[model samples]
Target: MARITAGIATSHIPALGAAIDLGKTGEDYWRPAFAGYEWTKQWIGQNPPDVVILVYNDHASAFDMNLIPTFALGCAENFQPADEGWGPRPVPVVEGHPDLAWHLAQSLILDEFDMTIINRMDVDHGLTVPLSLMFGQPQAWPCRVIPLAVNVVTYPPPSGNRCWALGEAIARAVAGFPDDLNVQVWGTGGMSHQLQGPRAGLINREWDNRFLDQLIGESDALRHIPHIEYLRETGSEGIEMVMWLIMRGALGRTTRCLHRHYHVPASNTAVGHIVLEPVS
Candidate 1:
């Protein structure tokens, strides 16, 4: 059986890429910010899991406001980088793990978790930004990816509990795979900040840190946190933290913390990162 060895959570602030590519990571304001991800870069190089199940939300990129599925799994052969208003990033398209993705989708559906399985889709900065930061544009990505996109755009999205349940389902699916492989699941986005009309640069470090601590040791508590409260306190878009609960729930109760980093003011959003290794 394959083992899920590591889990990670990071903010998908697209500006970070712009900052780095423009050679601003060393700027007075951004130097300390980019310094935080150094540990993550080193960890990935050392562990280098075979497959990375990237859990993130689409920012009105692939799925517009028309129709949104709470949880969508990508089982495609390839995914192109999206052209969000400005332009597409200079990077190769992401390749998918169809076999593993299909198996996981089948197992999850069998386990009573309804999923929107996608055969084709273009990935936006929500997914690519993190990949660019974690692993620069190599000739190819270091490992195969199973992109699980959650819908945090439309109103009345899945509850935190629902997201956590999906995580549990994912863990079961990964464990049931027959081949011996190492997998890492990542939940991207959020740590208290909003992007919208007037209330743009909101940051609640207290809530963000507490959310992180709970996710590591007591995620069950997070399932009960109401969405309205997350929006009220962390900001409307910050509700994306619910997605992290999915990654945490997938890891279950036994996980070893490897590295945790947090920063604020990344262009009106708080940036956070965490890495978890399953304890055998």
Candidate 2:
């Protein structure tokens, strides 16, 4: 049966993707931030998974305020990059694992999680940026991807506890599959930075680092964090960190943080990334 071998959490800042696409990563302003991921790229190249279940939010690209699904799963054979205002970030089309995605759709629904099954949808920076951060600028992504879009853009998003439960369910579903494939669950977004309003340039490094520490060691208490606390401490957009619970919850009872990277001032956002795997 397929198994979730590891979990990854990261912040998907759009400017990071732009720096990569525009050949500006070598510049001094972006060099330090890019340097942090060099090890991860090498690590992933040596240990590639058959498929990656990427959890991220849509930035008014695929789903607008008119139609927002609390949890949307991509079941199509492939997904196109979305054009967010300027244009799509010259990235390869995302290939989907329909067999596994469909199975997850069925399993998750039966497990009482209402998921909007999507046959086709364009993916935005929220999804592609994370891929770029890990895999670099390849002609095509190394492995198939299943897009699990969560609604953190709008108010009343899923609670941390609920996201954690969904991750647990996904692990159970992957284990039930008969194929002997290695899978990775990735939660992308967060580390505290806010845009808009009076606190437009907020970056609470202390709180962000503390959150990361708790995530690595005290996730049970982390999941209970209220949304208002995120807004108050990390900024409004910092609420995206809640998605990390999904990745953490899927990693079974015990896990060790193999790698952790944290950087600041990347497009006014904190870049946080961590790699975790089951202890046994």
Candidate 3:
């Protein structure tokens, strides 16, 4: 049966994608940020998974105000990179694992999670930036991807507790699959950032670090964090951090953090990344 081998969490800042596409990674302004992921790139190369269940939020690129599903699972044969204004990022098309995706969709829906099944949709930076961050400019991504787009773009996104529970359901579903596949669940977005309003450039390093600490050592408390605190403390956009709980939950009750990286001022957002595996 398929088993989840690990969980990864990172901030999916779109500018990071542009930096790589435009060859600005070596530039001093972006060098420090990209440098943080150098070890991850090498580490993933050594410990590649058969499939990665990428958890990220759409940024008005795929689903707009007209429609928004709290949890959307991609069951497509493939997903084209979305054209976010300045054309699609010059990256390889995202290949999907349809059989596994459909299985997960059915399992999750039966598990009492209202999952919107997506047969076709273009994935935006929320999904691709993390791939670029980990795999670099490969002609094709090394592993098949299963895009799990969470709804964090709009108001009243699922709570951290709900997201955490969904992750647990996902792990249960994956465990029941008969394939001998190695899987990784990745949750993307947030360290602390607000894009608009009076507190536009808000970022709380201390709070972000505390959240990371809780994520690794005290996830029970982390999962119960309310949305208001995220807004008041981290920023309006900081709510994106709730997505990380899903990855944490899927890793099980306890996990060992193999690696962690945190950097600030990456296009006015905090870039946080961590790799974890369940404690055996």
Candidate 4:
């Protein structure tokens, strides 16, 4: 049976990509930000997976208000980095595992998830930054990526419980696949910081840390946190944290944390990362 080897959650801040593209990783402002990912890079180097099921939201770069599917899965053979008003980052195009992606689409639909099947889509910093942080600037990404874009940008995004349920369904599809492949589901974005409007630069270090602790130790309790609480305490953008529950649910009820890091002020966002392996 195919297996889920690991789960990862991190913030997909666009500035992190700029830091990489401009070679400012060691600069004063970005030094601490980049430091948070150092352990993740080394861990991935040692324990690589065959494919990554990346869960992130598009920032009006790929999907505008006109077309926002609550859940969209990329089945393309490759996805180019989107030019989000600025020129596209100098990142390698992401390769897709079509055969597995197709199987997943079929499985998810039958399982009542109703995911929109995307044949072509441009992935934004939300997808690529995480790749850059975890794998560095490789000419070609080290493994295949299956992009799972969730609609957190919209007002009525999927609820936290709903996202968690989808991840649980995905776990079944992944395990039932006949091929022997190592799969890692990554839920990227958030750790309590908001951008835009009067509340532009809000950072809740205490809330963010408490979230990380609960995410690892008391995830079941974390789910009870309503969307309004995330908006009220974490800022509107901080609501993206619900995506992490998808990764957690995919790992089953028990997991072992392999590596974890949290840092602040990455372009007005608090960055958080955690690596987990199912307690096999």
Assess the local accuracy of residue 108 in candidate 2 as a C-alpha lDDT between 0 and 100: 97
Model 2 misplaced regions, further than 4 Å? none
Candidate order (TM-score): 3, 2, 4, 1
My TM-score estimates for the predictions, one after another, are 0.96, 0.98, 0.98, 0.98
lDDT: worst 10-residue window of model 2? 211-220
User: Judged by lDDT relative to the true structure, which candidate is superior, 1 or 4?
Assistant: 4
**Model 4 C-alpha lDDT per residue in residues 1-280, reported as the tens digit of each score:** 7799999999999999999999999999889888978888998999998999999999898789799999999999999999998899999999999999999999999999989999999999999999999999999999999999999988898888888888889999998899999999999989787778999999999888887786664357766688999999999888898899889889888778888898888888898999988875
Off by over 4 Å in 1: none
Best by lDDT: 3
RMSD of each: 1.3, 0.9, 0.8, 1.0
Candidate 1 local accuracy as lDDT? 0.85
For each candidate in the order shown, give its overall lDDT on alpha carbons.
0.85, 0.91, 0.92, 0.90
Q: How far is candidate 3 from the true structure (C-alpha RMSD, Å)?
A: 0.8
In order of lDDT, best first, we have 3, 2, 4, 1
Candidate 4 Cα errors over 4 Å, as ranges: none
Pitting candidate 3 against candidate 4, the one with the higher lDDT is 3
- lDDT by residue (211-239, candidate 3, tens digit) is 88877753589888999999999999999
